[model samples]
Target: MDLDQLRTFDRIVRDQSFTKAAAYLNITQATASMRIRALEQLLGVTLFVRGRTVTLTDQGMTFLPYARRIIGTAQEGREALRRVERGRVSIASLRTLVSPLITESLIRFQEHYPSVDVVVREGRQGQIAAMLHEREVEMGILCWPNIDPLVVDLEPLVIMRERVPLVVAADVAARLSSRPEIAEVLALVPRVIALRWWQADPETAAALVRLAKTSVELPTGPARRLAIKGEGLGFFVNSAIADDVKAGRLVEIAPVDFEPLHRDTAMVVRSLAALERPMLADFIREIALECAKMGEIIDDRLDKVVPRKPWPKPAIPHP
Candidate 1:
């Protein structure tokens, strides 16, 4: 029999009166009687004795435990499903952006949604893009100017803009004039260091070839380290080396009339449908907040070399 019929039967046995059972279950006495009758017909057995004080039949006694267990198990299963749905969020992000942009936001998110499990996967932009297309992750934080066709459906939120600066060791900068010509700086540098992705772009590759001899291609961390040691000139996002700049460990070389380079820091999802989840939405908002903080940090660092304008308002306001 159905769960409602079983519940009505159990309630009737407990109350020992159809009238009282109906009242307890918020149903009319006639409806409760009909449900009991239907349950008995389904099982082909009588469940109760009709008397001044009702009592359970042999069949009712045999079935009571099974009915209780079935309802309890079903409720447990539903609750388990709900917990699984509410308690997990998966995000993929670029290796470089994770520390500067995501770390603080993730900590804040954990504070707010203590029960929610946050899984962060780190990869390069291409790898993150592939994971999104394969449905391996729900959200991604990455560098913009990505033209991959797989990410065509990505709904992007531009959280920050990363400034790429030509940096050298402080000692190296002290040897040269305060504002050296681009050619003079390039001629003195032993080699150029850059991320592998920079060489992939034709225009950037050509520019690098013209600027200096490309001696090393490494991740942001190692390249910054080598540049700080005066081993080579490094090109990197300002956020990665902000502390170094402030501490006088690294110097940002501003060439005469040099055009500043920048890339967008974006958070993306596969589709608008992904935003329907409250967990994902809240996590995204936290990421945005963290990115805004990082933008300020980057601005402060960049301000040392060139004055920066205030950031524009965000298109999407947090709810």
Candidate 2:
């Protein structure tokens, strides 16, 4: 009758074991049994055969479809209510671009809708899109430009297209300057990398081999530290090193003459739903505005296409 009973009933039927279902549901076996019994009594029908096999009876089979439908409907209802109550908006973002402007936009959104809760998970551009497609998250911020077919809505947020030029500690740069051969330089240097986030293409890699003093790789935060320590030059988004460039902790080396990597940041949402939730829609709008305002400096293109909606609402703070 209730969601708890329906969930327990569904789990029991799916798992075919009341004990297993109870464990899965994080409840005691006795409570699971009582709930099922109560549900069966309410319907006045024996839904499950009382045996080790735990098979559904004829009556159970008849009620199975309805039970599933009930459970699904209940789940949808719960998700909707939670969305409304928490003003919860789930978003996945690339780790590099959670800047002050983005933070301000979120703060402003919360000021308008105090109940809204924002959850941000960080991943690569491709992975963020995948999360949206799977419905694991409602929205995504990604680095790549092209919209995938699976995306229900797309808003392009442009960011500065600052190429992560290679950089090294001043001492390291000085030490490597004398009689550098492409191979020798690469062998001497250990490249710092931001693990999975940095999008270094193959051509860049090959060119780096020819010019890099060593191919040292490190995780993003630590990689910055290593570069500061004069370990080796690493490729990273220009935003990541802005402070160091200003403070003289690291220096950009001679042009690698590599293709300039222009990353187009986008807000991606699944296409299936109409995004009827006001809180979620508002959250998306805030991000879109932030991107439009800040991403232009990097020549990042922020674009949004909703099949039905002809135009986005003007940027206005929520009342």
Candidate 3:
């Protein structure tokens, strides 16, 4: 018999009245009677005796426990499905942002949600955007200033604004006098190590192209390593170079003519509603916290190398 028929039979036995059971089930009394009749017909046995006081037949007594077990098992199965759905979160991010930016946050998230299954995949922004659009991933972490039309449907939650700094080995810094002009420094160092496909900021791109006669293109990790060995100057996220700068392995170089380059890094989702899941929401929160700490590290490093200067006011400012 169907679940409804079995449930109706159990309710009738529990309540001891079809009328009361129907009221509790939010169905008419006649409907409840029909369900009981249908269940008895399926089993080819009488389930109840009708009189001034209704009572279970021998067959009904034999079947009550089985029917209860069936309903309970079905409920357990549904709950298991819900648990599976709630216990997993999937994310994709740019390969470069994962190390210094998300590594600690992911560790904290795993500690907090020990049972949750978190999968993080790394790719370029375009690849991650495609994953999000195709539903291969629920969320993504990408560098900002992205204008891909594929991400038009996604919702962005900015985690932090990252300073893009030009850094060199300690020896390179020592060669240039304190706070030297950008052009003078560029004249000395004619080659720069940079990412091959990073074109987020046109000003930074133009500056590097103008100063450096030769460009060494590599991935983030290798570029940093090569820059550390004094192969060439490096342009990198401030957080990525924070440890090296603090430890005197690298030094930040101040660009005189151009304003400091910055890019926003964000956690993006297919929809705002995806954050409603507790696991996803908690993970995003942890990322935000970690990014805040990264910002502090960048600021502390910048304070040491870049001099504090007030912004120049606009000549025409009435708006």
Candidate 4:
């Protein structure tokens, strides 16, 4: 039976008088009687026996507990929604953006709202675009300068930029002085694994491809790994390589011809209206804060981060 009918039956049973129950519920006795009649007809069993004092039939006693549980569960669900104690959020992001920036943002968000669950899927622009179009996720992060969303419905939430560094493994760095000319560095370009995120710069891409002894394309994570292992030299965003440079796993070499390059990163959502949701909005704030912090770190190291000035190499004896 419906909630109204179930509630009427419960009120009558609790008060043990149809007349009194009607007054408590603010309904006429005729209305209460009509509700019980409808509930009994739906169940195909009488719920009560009418006499000088009304009492439950065997069927009413059996159904009471189930009705109470249904009401309690509905109330609990409403309370959980209000508290956001069990909320969930999902997003699609560029795998390249998942370093100390996005990953650190995830940690910050969890620290603040531990009860909220977050899911992140990494993909290229087309794949993330598809995910948003299918309603699989409400947000996506894109590496910029070549960024244009595939879906018209998507809207930008945040955009961050940082310098790009040309890094080689520590062992590779030992072969050259701290500030090598572009031609000197090119002589050692044995392998290059590049991310195609910069489709806007075809001339530069052609030059890199032609200069490298062996050039191949790979995802950011794998490319970073290969660069760390001395397998190749790569151009990477400072955020992705900052720790590597500090840890001596990789070295940033200032090459004379390579211009001071920077990469822009953007976060987008399915719509501006999505930010109206409290949980989504908070997530955006956490991520933006992390990105801003990353920008500050990048800015502080701007001279060394870009090839504009000589990068001070950690002392490593010449090979």
Cα RMSD (Å) per model? 13.9, 8.8, 16.6, 14.7
Among residues 3 or more apart in sequence or in different chains, the pairs in candidate 1 whose N, CA or C atoms overlap within 3 Å are none
Query: Candidate 2, residues 100-146: lDDT per residue as tens digits?
Result: 33687788777776656677787766677778777778877675554
Query: Model 1 over residues 14-43: C-alpha lDDT tens digits?
Result: 899999999999999999999999999999
Q: Measured by TM-score, how close is model 1 to the native structure?
A: 0.64
Which residue runs does candidate 3 get wrong by more than 4 Å?
1-86, 196-199, 296-319
Order of the predicted models by lDDT, top scorer first? 1, 3, 4, 2
In order of appearance, the predictions have TM-scores of 0.64, 0.58, 0.63, 0.60
Candidate 3 per-residue C-alpha lDDT over 31-147 given as tens digits, one digit per residue, 9 for 90 to 100 = 999999999899999999987667899998999999999999999898767867758788897776777657888888777676676778899888988898898788898765467
In model 2, where is the ten-residue run with the lowest total lDDT? Answer: 300-309
Off by more than 4 A, model 4? 1-85, 145-149, 177-179, 199-202, 296-319
Local error of candidate 3 at residue 5 (angstroms): 39
> What lDDT score goes with residue 298 in model 4?
28
Q: Whole-model lDDT, candidate 1?
A: 0.76
Model 3 clash pairs are: none
Query: Whole-model lDDT, candidate 4?
Result: 0.74
By the TM-score metric, which is better: model 1 or model 4?
Answer: 1
